[model samples]
Target: MASSKDAYRRKINQNSDLGVMRHQVVSLSFIATPFWRKNGIGQRSPATCRFPKVLGTTKGVKRGLVLPLVATSSQEARSGVNASELPNRGADRLREAVTAREAAFLAVEQSLMQNATTSDVEGTNASTDSKMSRDSPNASHLSQKFLLSYLALWSEARKPSRAEYALAKIISFNAVRQRMLFDYVLQTNVLREREAMDSVPRRIKSDNLRLSVSQRALLHTALAQYAFMERVPVHTIVFSTVELAKTYYGQRFASFVNAILRNLARYGEKWMPELERRRPAEYIVRPLPFPEDNLNVRYSYPGVFVAKVANQLMNQERVVAFLEAGNLTPQIFFRIPCQFTDTAELRAALEIGLLVPWDGSRLSESAARPWNIYRVDLNCADVDGAGDLVIAANTDRVEWAHALPDTSAKDLFQKLLQKFIVQNVTQAEHIYDLCEQLRARWNQRRRLERVLDLCTAPGGKLTAVFEYLQKSGLGDLLTEYVGVDLNGQRLQMVHENIHKAPGMSKGRVFVGIGRGESFVEYQSGFVVQNADDRSIVPSFDLVIADVPCTNSGVLNRRPEARWRLSERDFATAIPRLISLQTSLLTRALRLSRHAVFYMTCSILEAEGSGLVRSVLEQFPEFELSWERLTYTDTAGRDGGYAALLWRHQEN
Candidate 1:
């Protein structure tokens, strides 16, 4: 036991990027030229050049520490370097001598602006600063700056226009994904600046000017680019951010934003050197800040969610990897229908099948064919503005749709069957194989005709069942695929997905708007409609009750989920979701004659294993035939749980 414990300890101490930050900001340095070629490095991009080093090096040292530009000498220096002047190069040698002076100037400027700007952030002691009296009634136009707006979070619950929503994801997804890290960096930096002020020393107080929501949103997006998006030109980041602040707020707020971004460019670089290595517009999936981080802060996941993973796994390394995996945006998964055996399929199949060894199936031989599932290469997968597919997103769960691709185009997917977020598609693939195996077994004695999806809105799983039934030549065996969902708008997705598949259109499917926990009326209608056979009918042969979850396991797919969940008192939700899940599962079990597939896209024990365990203990009639609670360590996959509850029958 001692040796076993020691071995586990050794695994935790593995050489994972777990520890304090690597780079440290020694001090600010004055440089002749702007970092981004006064703007852009043109051909010499960030990919080939090391960051801060690309900016400029002095005394054999790399200095990324920054201060806002306020000069013609800097401009002359930049133009000179761009033109390759020896005199400008000579001036660059004096960077060390002017470092102290630049640092002092920055401190003085900040101290002068400290009292006025401290309140522009979330957490700061601004009570020490006195408030100005109300503006004169004649100057009411000044109040327009207070009207603030932020980028709306895209969710599965909301139905947004495809084009407009696509724009939102491009603007806000990564920024929101790294909200915690950037916010923490800003909050801490704000505190330090407040302390530098000649103000009260403790017990955090605030009454200073607060950042409008729009300003904060703009700031976060800017910081995400400035700090995390390494390949973005520094000039673009700073100029755009400053202008955004100016347009939304007054000129004062613009100055505040300029200063904050400048400090972060220097400070955040050292605080998060990991950004130096990441690709442009890409996300960070490794342990952030390098060396180490708390599970929640490290991945920007909620603390409750992290605690759940920690408690469930009881292994630090597994927990870290699982969290990291959640941040990995898998290459887009394109579900290609089996019937589309075009020239595109013949060519694209070999490439896709080789890239992904999904379910141990890939086309090495010319005789081999592609399955319905294929991961799309976005680079190769081009969308013409003239094309039908207006690409919604590359990473987000809510936008896993291409505006119904051009049917005429002879692309890889050949009119594309469907697009699903990695987690959803992964779950569907596993469930599809499981249900297929069950159907084969059940077919020996009975047809196993009826199926029920208890909560099937935006039906990915139900559609997978359709694919299985049609492809396996078992379309006739299943009579009814009943779908019950509360949301009418989302239930329409089920109809669309079903219609997309060949031979599985309106014939065998029945959908109704109703609650999952108490949907006996819908089941009754289906059974009565099919009472002609009278084969000792149960409401459904297979019941799918994939209940609602916190979605802790797929944080990368749904960047907004954690923040929204945090706001909804997630701590109290445990008992509530469990109760809801239990009732839904109970309804599913009662409705199923043969098997009830209970699933949740969650890693928490209570939601998955523990809940299943209790269900079995109470209802011994249903045995656990197959069950799995998986945590993803590898990238491009997601964590989730599934349990098959089957009623044992004697031969």
Candidate 2:
């Protein structure tokens, strides 16, 4: 029997397809195991378990023998075994082992498939749950990470400052206006597309999908570039986004971000046509079918505000033009000092255009007049100082007093003017004109012994008052000038601006830190009495209360203001602003001996006319002498409301 087995083993080993037999033996081990026997196969002995090892080995062949052995001689035949029959039995066992192995493999594959299916369903459920409760602790961490990572400078505690706006614009490719729109698309459109492709629901809120700060910022920039900016190439946008992600996030996150942006680039444009077709009447997409509705989205003006403006203007065409005008950056107008030499040369070099003189004679014809025809008269200076000079070339849009040309000339002119004429740059608005008019009118009545400028930070009105005093030949008569502001930084700015004037001495101008509401009265030309302590301060013949209000009129100059101002914001702000304005005006009335000029940069009736009406009703002693409300839509300058109030004193 041993000889017969040896002969069979030698025959198998000698065959080139022994490797195939070894594979069969290895697979049969799975069926021979006790675990398999418990399931279906019959229980085998320990000798049978060693069969696979025996087949695998080259040196030793002795092991559990499953094959039925046959003898070659007559003596072996009597035992029902033959050498030739043994080979056939071996072949039969090998075939049986292969069949058993295949059954085991099929069972394993089915079990694995079932387990995977169960796990996938569970994962899907968990993902759905995560999306539903996106404000979970984990999601909060993600939200915070998203905000901090992209917009490091932004915080919920404070509003975005000018410096922050500037920084955001630089990183986000000047897409500051489209920030909210971009976010809207990302949360609603982009996120939806991603969710459709992926089975795993993104951990995103249905209403407000929270992305990492970097992710949000990058998405906004990319979308803005892809949708609006045709000049910017797709690859450049992708590269910039990837680089930004890598800089803030790790390489792994960068790869993840890269995949998302690439997907956007591929499929983003296809949706444009559909979006346009499905766009709501109020909402506007690019390549506008209706130009009338475009300003609401294109200029980023709130729909409510746009409707309000349309109602106020009473003309949809005018409303569109006004909104369009507001989107443009206003021209920087400079007031040439009486003392600055080479006025003609500067005017010629700059190609400076003059503001239409406010004499009321050429009110209609001024819009048609050429730029060169308008003259700057230094000797007979009005509120605008002869005439205001636009630092850049004027545009053909005659609706604005000056629409600055978008050219290299504008850039070069701004640079030269800033370098050469440092402190002469003044915004040509109706408020400044009002300030100058107030100062001139008061000085004409009686020389100003002292002047008080309340809330006088950024110091434009105060500086104008000083310049007016100098130009009107009342510089000697003005003994002291006092500027008070609640903000310390603005008070410092007042001090700095005061120092710029050649005639203004250190002792002449005093910038103090105090709320306008606190200072109710003044005793002498050198003393002020508030709730705190009595301080030596200059009493005033004139008090200019340029109180803070909703900067609605100057929306054209301040692009971010449109987003910041809402109907709710105005509703809440107007009442508080009215209170503050009332308090400041009352205090100014108490302090001034001759006149008080109450001014606001708001076009709203509630902020200007309403506030003034309330004050007049409260104080019967004061009378309104002169009031002017310049509307930007009509006047082509920033709209403002100014009322000159004077007390009737017994002779």
Candidate 3:
């Protein structure tokens, strides 16, 4: 029998990594032990062996002897044992703590399902007695998120795939101990911990109480991870947990937690497996259709549905191309010696762009012709504090006018500003950082030139371009650092922010509120046809067209948009958008020696790469060059954009 087990293991290893289901075989071996001895040896061992009766197999193998007799090579067996020890220990502990909680949670889910099924099965005549979904103690602890997490963990555990384990670590509980802790949290309201069950509020008393062995184990694992992962504060963890619990289970979270924790404290080590035995079938069989690419990019995302949405926008193949091509989230490049070399400085400047001094009220109130100013605050709740600062020019001017720090805090603020800017600033700051990188690249190419930003309103990228030019010694070539936009208000912002050369502030940057694709009349053939058109007069030596896109890449900034978006809307809009791009690019190509056309969108295949492809195909005279950007810690979340540069040489 031992030799036979060894032979089976050898066959498994020889088959190849793709074929060897190591964990499955190990589980099967355990299940086969009793059958192996019972039928193969034709004898029953002493009652000392603690084994389940269901170990019998479909093949003629009996339960008692099959598993024990199967032998593995010593090295293989040792490796397996070593690999299993940590998880086993963690699982065992988790089971001990969360078994009861598991049972309670399972009971709640079962009752809910049963009640739902009964309601469905019996229709209007279904008894109200079985109609209550949250009528168990564990119902308070169970939420859609919690249940999904549990289902994910259990589904992963019963299979050989490590995908579940990876997901389990992110969204579900990993071991039995974590569940035990979670159970305790659900069952207790610390202030009223001693209250009798009957005295509990009617809402609390009627919550679900179902759970099982595996779920309890899962709870423990989650708890263990929560306890570690040093980045988040414990209070934040507790707050998040409570919030999550309430989102799903409602009023019963406290009491459910209390009961689970008490059990964990008492019998965590002893009764884990017994509790696991009662795990629900739903927990084990839940299916996951999560995209593999998203799995790597967005580990913190909690729901599979959300992952599905992300997958539709950015497929794995594109994500891989983006990664392999080394285009990622761009870095925040800053010029030194500026007092406000961060988001705060950028924020105040509004239209000046880069890390410069700013006066928000001035930019907002300025009545100049071509004002380049805008803000984007990423935090959903804090609308005012979020947003990027945009201007159409370079860094030196921005720093001189806006971010010039006061004498008092100059040294201290400068020393510690980088840390705060990187760590605590708003979402717009991240965008500003990326723009800065582009600014640096622009400076690298054109050493000393009075650059023109033709379509530079709401000027984060514009300001970055300006600053990069300034730092690269191009300020001397400032005959005309012109900024043009149709918005008079934004141009006014540009006027108010520019302090270049004192009197030359008015002379160096000719702020014009005008259209790029126009001949003084500000009317292109397409615009004349549309009638609902507005334009400002503009043509320059350098044109930057960061055209409007679907804006799907920055969903975190505008979550309200995710639900509102659809393929139909995109289909209808893309043609119009492309027309606008063509209009801008045509004018840009003819007007400027070199032109850059860029947009921020994760659905790069269509809106970005496709757009570039279309332009190159249509305009044979214009040459296109491409560069990929960078994003950090976004393995799972999508934010890769495409920048296409078209240098127009005389045809």
Candidate 4:
């Protein structure tokens, strides 16, 4: 397994340096036609882009290069067109360029396939990155922006403009988010001609205009643009994608690229049913139940998830809202210490024009939200709260993350009043609520100070947990606070976050690396071991288990989680995930002296309510006192599940 740091570096190379081109892929660039014409390369063909007389047909290749003259919605009539004519070129040069580019394409095709398959499998926190996607966890915790940055670098375009980066980010996320639907569309219209789902994608003779996984990814990118970004011109989508194939793969692919994308436009776009930007994502995702093609693509989720929805929520409109919410861009929200009172100042610093209602207001939290958290809108969310941005007395700050970008006075809020963690309103609200509940008990039992924040990444919820506890007057009560995570580097962050807070005696507040199920309570502190301990270990007064899940509820924020997940595959994956969730909760109970906190960032019943019932059934001594499930809302908050479990029979 790649270390999280190594994985983090690999993702960096993919997006920034393309240093991993040898192992993954190398992209090449083709200047767009309009940009070329504007630069005095007017109308003459840029070295023979037409088909060879030897190929015997020009199915997709045209006399002109493929690019679009973009027009706004107001000028709807000029939305799209094919490439413009280019100058004829020497035959020898055409053939040579064709062979070299085609060969490059062939080399990277397999790597592209393998990389796409791994999109949802692993993650590591990419705190050092400065992109919008950095704050939101990348798939495997890096590279939600990986592929597009990857394409740009391999193509030797070097640094992309912020606009290019933003476009790539949106396309990359949409491709992953709606991969199933895109694949479904391609499979039905084009891929069925060759795709072999049971095994590796077999290559066809190059003469037949074969579709490689590289081409499939390109098509997916194009499709994502047409479906999600309303302003993108269809002809431009064609040109960009076809040029991608022509420049990187060779001219051999440009025609096929041209043909497939036009077909894509025909089916779900410009010429077909005419998908509208405001319409729900399900508009073009319809396939009949008889084909086993349920609305999984419409919802961009697994069939097992769709079935679980029917069993759990059981309401049509609510389900639609839930699905639609995950497809919209999630907002950037932060948690303020309950102690802060400078709302007017904070708002002035972070605001542009209108201040929307609190996220709590959506949850009917009109009172608690205004004081607990205030939403800050910035075009960039990856601002590291360094220097003047610090919001605390002794450098304690909340670090929150968001993947998408927003529009605002990017300069005015470049620095903020408080260094707070990037958090969802609903999530922060729930955590605050949980701490308040713990407050009553802590008031009675002053000795309940030992705390274990289990399975959290570095600085995750640990900082928030401390602040919430402080507000409840329980901050000074802690003698031992141990934050445990699977990643050592992230745990180091936990140490950095908690080590500075008021209660610091050596070894009293620290972090341990390894699974919570095997973490051992050591003398005055904690240590994480890979296996069972032979020696006795003490228990924590409260164990907060923010266990991992499928990230179903947060698909908008965690798009990578959706890939590698399918209706058929979820049957296997969900069970394994439930097993892990079960193990973490079961172990947390054993490790706790008083109560165990079980939480997941998932809306699936199998992982949320259902799995909890199953796990608790085995332990008759524990009872669920309270649990809250916040569904993903169109208002931009990520969904989460949090529950408090009490041990009735004392140890």
Candidate 5:
């Protein structure tokens, strides 16, 4: 029912309304926008603006030009408006203004330097000065002085160690604060090889030509005199000498080194790659058959052996993609202590680029204020694209559970159990049930006689055991609490913490520093030894043998372990496990009434049941007490841990 002209008018009004609303919203952002976004923003003026107060107050101001009433009265009234409307141009200009003292000092220095130097400054000219200068006596002398002074400075900057230049080049490249060119040189390894060649001693061989020679030259002829005179590689020495000569002397000196090096490279068959080309038969046109199934270039291992384990443990595709992603490129993270005036101020000053939250679980800012500000850590990673995995990297361990490929599910789950333990007490009963077969013995044994803690050093488990004993009031009942370790330093920890918490029975806690075989003399007390070591000790009663095996349980704990582990390691560990069991059982039968061998490794028959089988075969006196332990009865377990109790009856 609407007329065409009326519809057009409505459309125009709608568009005008939209335009006014859009402009109003955008206008709100102009004056109050963030300072960082203020760059390139143009100045805006109100329509029909009044003249400024300076112009209005002028004595010759025209009546028509100025606002109504008295010009003075309007000027006074419009002062606030003028002040508010004025550009903040002078605000930024204040930051650039140089102090009077500084300008005066710089003026004096400029005049003195220009007059005092004959042609050029001491450290300003030479190869770095790409600008061409007029040739004159004074200019040439000044250039020579500058070169000498610059070279002296360069020489002084060299590190003290002989190979320090090479090492420093690498270290400085890796350092976050260093120049990008240093990183490029390090990546190329140009300086590394140069330093190596420059380290050798030299002797003058040709007195007439005055060619300096190294010991290697004694084995070659005089044709190699110029090249063999120095320990440096012929090509490197020639190229470097030529480059330096061109910088200082002229192109002719560089040409001299080049011609000599070409001859040396031709004759130096012992050092350089051969460049001879033999002609093939011109008429031959027979096709060579290529085997389709041949693995001529396939089936070889990827990267290093250790890297293989890491790849297997981590989600390789996701990790690779994540590393390539700019988002994950080692973000800069800092652990700032709470000492600065405000954490925000310090963070602002220190933050040069993007910052990310720390990944470690243990990264907690201390409640202690000022000290906390100073004690923060800083880290950096670059961000790539969205396809890469967002790694929860705390130190070296990067866990990307969701990022792993579908094919890697089995390995992924297996490693997950190894990395985390059930901290919840409600979950512990189910976890404990899956760990050991001898449920009856664990339930019946109201009192524990002797406890063995194998692999007890670096004791997360040790602390738990001590706490368990303390809570149960079983610490007093423990006659001999033995902690075994191979590391001398870790043994020191066992010695210290065991005495402090849940004090063991008087004179019963024994700390063994050496390998398990070192305790072969004793049939009882406590013994700590590596499983592969010689088994000389007597049998134990309650053996707490936390045997060493493929650490598949802790893939998350050791990211590198996944790539390092192989079928060969699994195969190799079986025999070692048997040997360890033989050693421990031999000692256990003589010492304890029963043994409890605990391990973080899976309860695969190879390590747990397989070794138990070998122990039963060798010692007929011992029996697998089904009533005391019940580990194997359950199916489809989470941790894949199993326990078996071996009792040596009185024969």
Candidate 6:
């Protein structure tokens, strides 16, 4: 609508507006423009146009350059000339700056796209180092791999699975022999590193953040592998860890992981003196500077558990010995089944030498002499030597002189003899002795009838009872054998074991899934009712109530329990455990017309003697016939407590 000069002026102003928009979008500090000076739109003196202090250094730009649309000064705004009067140089310079800014914006967008694509493929093997040798035989490659895989899966909290047991077996293989060593190394390092960070300087600590769950697991595995892989070079350990980090996580984490493992490999021996000791026994038995203060850290036991043990043992030295014994891998013992009388079959089944019987008389003069025999004195007071059972060593039990570690013998016996072996195979000697005493008491009474086992899952004691009835020539006299458990799964296991036991008919053995306290409630469908159904639920001659306890005495076999258990757990669990035990025992006493054997694997008086005393207080009609508190140190067996009670007979 206007003349050619006005139209030209409008076109120049529009182009300048676009140039300002491009500059803002690209976030550039300033763009040089000789066109502005040539047109006299801004300061003509180059010295007067400098970059503002807010924008960083302008090394690339010429002097007197200014950002588009940014005001130069109040005087310049008031004195500005019209665009129509300005020359074409100003528009030309603006167009050039716009083109440059647009190009830069494209470059930034392209860079962001590339980064997103790269992040998509982050965990791929692109950044992995090739230094890790998968075929290295010096390292326990399988064990390390298994450990890493397992920790990755379980480091985050979740319910335990059977896979843990399988992993334990693989890690503890004789070929590896790194289970305890590795566990100790990993746990100790994790605790120490976590505590050590608190002591770090605040300034340095800001940059040094806490290790993440995955990071902690990886670090623990690396340090553990380094400690036990004596045959592997230190560089190999470091290299493998770095490669693992880069491959699984990314390069960002690789350097941090590599540094931790390298430091441990280099300075661990001096910093942690325990690492220098290769044998678990060495570390276990060594006296600490302050035994009470260092008990948890040195022994890898819960502080409360250590305190309780130290208190019970009275002497500090004895406490140490007891703890050492618990950590030692136990020896294995196998009892010959009554069905297999052939010595050759027995020897083949056990895969160990057959010594002369408890009677010194040999099967034949040419029979193999015992390899080793020592007359060790028996230390317990309850077990008395009787007739030929008593040796000059004041021990009632005869010696079978072969010694083998449990691990070596576990698999063989488990594979061959588990199903068909005696009612009691690989059972603690003290348990067998207790059963024998129970059998002797029954023989004295000369009356064997119904038997009830409360808290019977996995059916060990029930099997022993069946075997006793058969051997004592009272199998036909026993009308019923009942086993009860609250857990249906465990009750099923008891049924399976009972089915496999010899001299036991399926009809004679009853496995019930019910709470021991209210066992009669579950028997409704089975026609076992109140006094109206007299024949269905008859009185039992014997009731064996082996109640649940903390199992503190069997820590040697259940090492994982040490970590899973805590002092607070004990405090919370003990009251409930005692309540359940009391209920079970009371029910057993109610059902038993003659006698009840109350038993527990716990060595704690609160669970054993104290519990029995409480029961006696509640029911004064029952008299404690005999009681025995067996110590692992004294009996040379797993610790347990048993009290036999008999009902006071009415006139």
Top model number, lDDT: 4
Write model 2 residue lDDT over 384-414, tens digit each, in one string.
1112221111111111123334444444454
Clashes of 5: 63
Give Cα-based local distance difference scores for all models. 0.48, 0.44, 0.34, 0.51, 0.30, 0.43
> Tens digits of per-residue lDDT for model 1 on 108-215?
222212212222111111000000000101112211111101112112223344433433334354556665665554453343241221112112222222332223
Q: What clash count does candidate 6 reach?
A: 0
Best-to-worst ranking by lDDT: 4, 1, 2, 6, 3, 5
For residues 1-651, what per-residue lDDT tens digits would candidate 5 score against the true structure?
977545654554476532222222211100111111122334332232222232233344323222211111221121112433312211222122132111111122122222222222112221112111111012123223222122122223331221222211111111211111111211121121112211121211110111111100110111121211222234543454344333322343234335434433433432232212110111101111111122110111112322433343366443332211211111111222223225444444335322323232121321211111121111111111111222122121122222322333333323322322212121122223322333234434454555655446544344444444443443444455666665554455555444434334244666665444234432354343433334534344355544544333322121122222334444453345445545654444444455454443432345455566676686676675531111211111112233445565431
- Positional deviation of residue 36's Cα in model 5 after best superposition, in angstroms: 45
Backbone clashes, candidate 4: 22
List candidate 5 stretches off by more than 4 Å.
1-439, 442-446, 469-478, 496-507, 521-540, 567-590, 600-604, 623-640, 648-651
The TM-score measured for candidate 5 stands at 0.32
Q: What is the lDDT of residue 312 in candidate 6?
A: 73
Kindly list the per-residue Cα lDDT of model 6 for residues 1-651, writing each as its tens digit. 777545544554576543233232321111212222213354433224332331222344323322222222222221123424222322222223221111111122222222212221111110110001111111112121222222222222232222222222222221122223333343333222322211121111111123322233344345433433233345655775575455434544565555445444544444345533423435222211122335554445667877877777788777766666555443333334446445453454334432222322121221121111111111110011100111112111222222322443344344433454222111323334444555555544454667788677667677666765665554553457887765554565576667656657544677776556555533433523232222233278778887766556654543333432356556664565667677777777777777787877666777787888888887787888777765544223455678888777621
Residues 594-628, candidate 4: write the lDDT tens digits.
78777777787777777888888987888887888
The candidate, 3 or 6, that scores higher on TM-score is: 6
* Residue 313 CA displacement from its true place in model 5, Å: 17
- For candidate 4, which ten residues in a row score worst on lDDT? 82-91
lDDT of 3 by residue, 52-150 (tens): 221223233222212212222332221223433523332332233222223223322322222212212121111111112111112122221123323
lDDT of 6 at 123: 14
Clashes of each: 6, 10, 113, 22, 63, 0
For each candidate in turn, the TM-score is: 0.61, 0.54, 0.36, 0.67, 0.32, 0.55
In candidate 2, where is summed lDDT lowest over 10 consecutive residues? 26-35
